[model samples]
Target chain A: MGVQDAEPLDVERIREDFPILDREVGEGTDLVYLDNGATSQTPESVVETMSEYYRTYNANVHRGIHRLSQEASIAYEDAHDRVAEFIGASGGREEVAFTKNTTESMNVVAYAWGLSELGPGDEVVLTQMEHHAALVTWQQIAKKTGAEVKFIRVTDDGYLDLDHARELITDDTEMVSVVHVSNTLGTVNPVSELADLAHDHDALFFVDGAQAVPNRPVDVEAIDADFYAFSGHKMCGPTGVGVLYGKRHLLEEMDPYLFGGMMIKKVTFEESKWNDLPWKFEAGTPPIAEGIGLHAAVDYLESIGMDRIQRHEERIVEYAYDRLTDHDDVTVFGPPGDDRVGLVSFDLDGVHPHDVSQILDEHGVAVRAGDHCTQPLHDVLGVSATTRASFYLYNTREEVDALVEAVDAARELFAV
Target chain B: MVGSDMYRQQILDHYRNPRNHGELEDPTFSHVGENPMCGDEITMDVELAEDGETIERVAFRGEGCAISQAAASMLSERLPGKTLSELREMDRDDVLDMLGVDISPMRIKCAVLAEKVAQDGAEIYLGEKDLDRTSTE
Candidate 1:
């Protein structure tokens, strides 16, 4: 599949931005890092932006009146605005809340919103394909509040069963929380349609956009989501930073997930009045450098254009799908190659994914093996585990070829 | 890459053709262990001797990578005829030696899941045996 592209963005130029692309592993085999879904490699731009912040204006934001504090505060607050715009968030700056990671973002909503709104006999809806972050958060909230959880079934080819989803999201449903993209299955869900469905039933909708935000364009307004959550590390930003975009009304009604310094306006010995919209949620000292780095990451993605990156990944995924299917023993999961995101999760005929990955390691080909923190999704797919190879802007067709070659080598080593 | 190393031919052989691979009918003791990180699970069952001092039989059922399954199969073969005390003294290094492969720190979970399950079951079996004896007397 040497199909030519329309060339909105030069992928070769994009690959040049990632310094890790030229790395060597093991005994000098060229590195083929395919674990972007776990964490994408950072570019020089993100590195420089964060480093410049530390060297130039390193101070606590929104606290000090010094020139350094003013500049740092501007950069940090600007990051929240950039991130909001990145997702096409209509609620804008007042909607964004920075947290530790996507997991923390989900916890904030579950603890702050779900715990307060949901009650006994109220239903929380979730798809079987949800990552542990979103699924476990809702489960615990349901348990604490005596609420019930309903699951939407997955179709045979790994798409969400809308018929089942319709049945599950009934009038009793208080919230509909699902992953926008399946991290292990590579299925890009219809977030807008699901959001519409959730709204029709008078239920709040939350999209775990952890995997989707890195691969495709996500317009929160268009989707009509009440809340959307994603992480920075998965999108080539530094760790310890994530975003939770909730509607202003919801944020105002809910209690803060964390309570401490910086989240309060008036501090008394007995009682404390909380801060406004975003500040009410961001407790303690926030990750200033990480917030600035995330802004740089958003800028990097915008420079390439999300649609172009999507198209680029589509070609690479199609090629990888074709290459993987060439093997008689391989079984790729999720929908067909055309329907998935930039990743492919699959298993060999007899080889376990961990063994396959270990053999791939010997070839300097990196892949994620195991349950992928979505064990229930793997259980739905009737597999204990799988090996996943994911792509990003820096990945190439040649890198996919290396992945196939390494997989072939693994098959040979494990062949009976 | 697997040339006579950790992923040896013998390990693959044991993995493909596991011995005593199913459960015993209402065994005296049974325990399931899982490597939560990798989702590898092993359920070990043991039939205690009439005297309750020894394991009369052992069987395991599991699904995982070659190392974990192979280790389970190999451990099952050696479990029968071992005293409860002997089973309790089993160590991680002993299982590694039995597998005849050098496992990495990352995969220590894979190679040791079976032993972990078995030893845990053995401990419970020994404790229950004492409790039964005391209550009966």
Candidate 2:
């Protein structure tokens, strides 16, 4: 759908699509789920899609020539096509590969590219706000390859210091990987600009879109991202499936990271030939039902229009940020203006995040409390942990009010 | 006032003004325990008597929610006048009884961080095990 054709979301109608939204938490209290940053609630359509796939065509994909296998293969390939279209990948399904999750996708890049391309003097540039999936994977690979790893600094207000990024991305930089949207800080990075900068330095760029692709409109072609990774579970789809999109030329140049049955064209006692484009990277039986479920989720988002979802989450998060900061005891982290995405991380004076989250749970408000997989970023923020409340398309302003009231109850109980 | 049953007045008082809330000048055993998931940490410093089996004095330093800090404070107070064997024998129920509150399954780690630290410290002091630190992951 075009951006101009996007309509405002009817949140009340949308909430009905998710049965979990109607459930109760503690003492029969209505659940206020604000943990979308962790995992989004699946719609009934996506759930039904997976259930139907197992019930109807319960067979292996790609190898079997039987009717069920053909049907499953067609559906799985179509799922990849849907994902490629959703992200505006120019090479379409040929450039998209499925992995267990975003972590595995990054590992695939590290194994296929980093292991072969990087050497002792090569540098891998990453941001300080990266989730451990990107940080630890590259750290270990750099160690194994004897490649140096550099980190771009985050400003005190929680932004990637572009000046620092420019200073760091010089001649020796062989790879630049960054999070498109920070899970902890909710900072929406200028990824396209970063991608251009990396290309200018003759470096490969990778975007960890685990937090970005689900919440906003992303066109890999527009941003010129050499590689992008995202998970289905964070976007109203089932777990056990993720997507990795790379340029066709780069994908062809890199060797397969996984080796198994379906990914082989022919196998002999002495030699084996790899399969074509995406399947060469996708080994083993693959997550057949999960890929189909992700397709349904992509259709659901497309029906609602991503532009509209982005606007709704923007309003909800801004309102939440304002309400949370109104209290003297609360201190909200991240950018002060409207540059942030759909989450808010904050701390209460004299009250631990776990305590705040526990109290919020008592009121049936679910939130995330911890380092959010970015321990270094937490250290940079000068705090141990922060309570985070994230919003999605189905969230409403009333729920934001409920979150504020529960937070108030926590502060009052702690007498902070 | 939701979950007030878990945050009783005693827990709050101990959390606010923790007893034995400092480090000992010289300690027979000092160990740090951490629940990295919640960023809760507790450090216990115990000074043994001449007999080397009884805890003569103890102090604790920590940063965490009320359950962890209050439980650590209470554990520090109970350490003195208790033998090392008794300290080792202290279990989850004892910590729950000391808190006098219902700790949910998720917060049980926060509630029992102190007991683990002390017991592990006692083990290290006795040369029963060689370890760097303790973790309630």
Best by DockQ: 2
Candidate 1 off by > 4 Å: A1-9, B1-4, B19-32, B43-61, B76-87, B128-137
Classified by CAPRI criteria, candidate 2 counts as medium
Which 10 consecutive residues of model 2 chain A have the lowest summed lDDT? A1-10
For candidate 2, the TM-score of chain A alone relative to the native chain A: 0.98
Q: Give each model a TM-score.
A: 0.91, 0.97
Which ranges in model 2 have alpha carbons more than 4 Å from their true place?
A1-6, B1-3
lDDT of 1 by residue, A1-416 (tens): 12134355687788788878888885667899999999999999999999999999999999999999999999999999999999987667789999999999999999988878889989999999999998888999999999998889888898999999998998999999999999988888998999999999999999999999997778898888999999999998999999999988988998998999999999889999999879899999999999999999999998877777778888888889989989889999988988788899999988889988988877888999988888888888888889999998788899999999888887877776
Error of 2 at A277 (Å): 1.3
Candidate 1 per-residue lDDT, tens place, B62-86, comes to: 7778898999999989888888778
lDDT of 2 by residue, A1-416 (tens): 75435677999999999999999885679999999999999999999999999999978998798999999999999999999999999788999999999999999999999999999999999999999999999999999999999999999899999999999999899999999999998999999999999999999999999999888999999989999999999999999999999999999999999888888899999999988889999999899999999999999998998999887888888899988899888889889636788999999998999999988988889999999999988999999999999999999999999999999888888883
Please, what are the lDDT tens digits per residue for candidate 2 over residues B7-107?
A: 88889889988999999999998999999888889999999999999999999997999899999999888889999999989899999999999999989
Pairs of colliding residues, candidate 2:
none
True-vs-predicted CA distance for residue A301, candidate 2, Å:
0.2
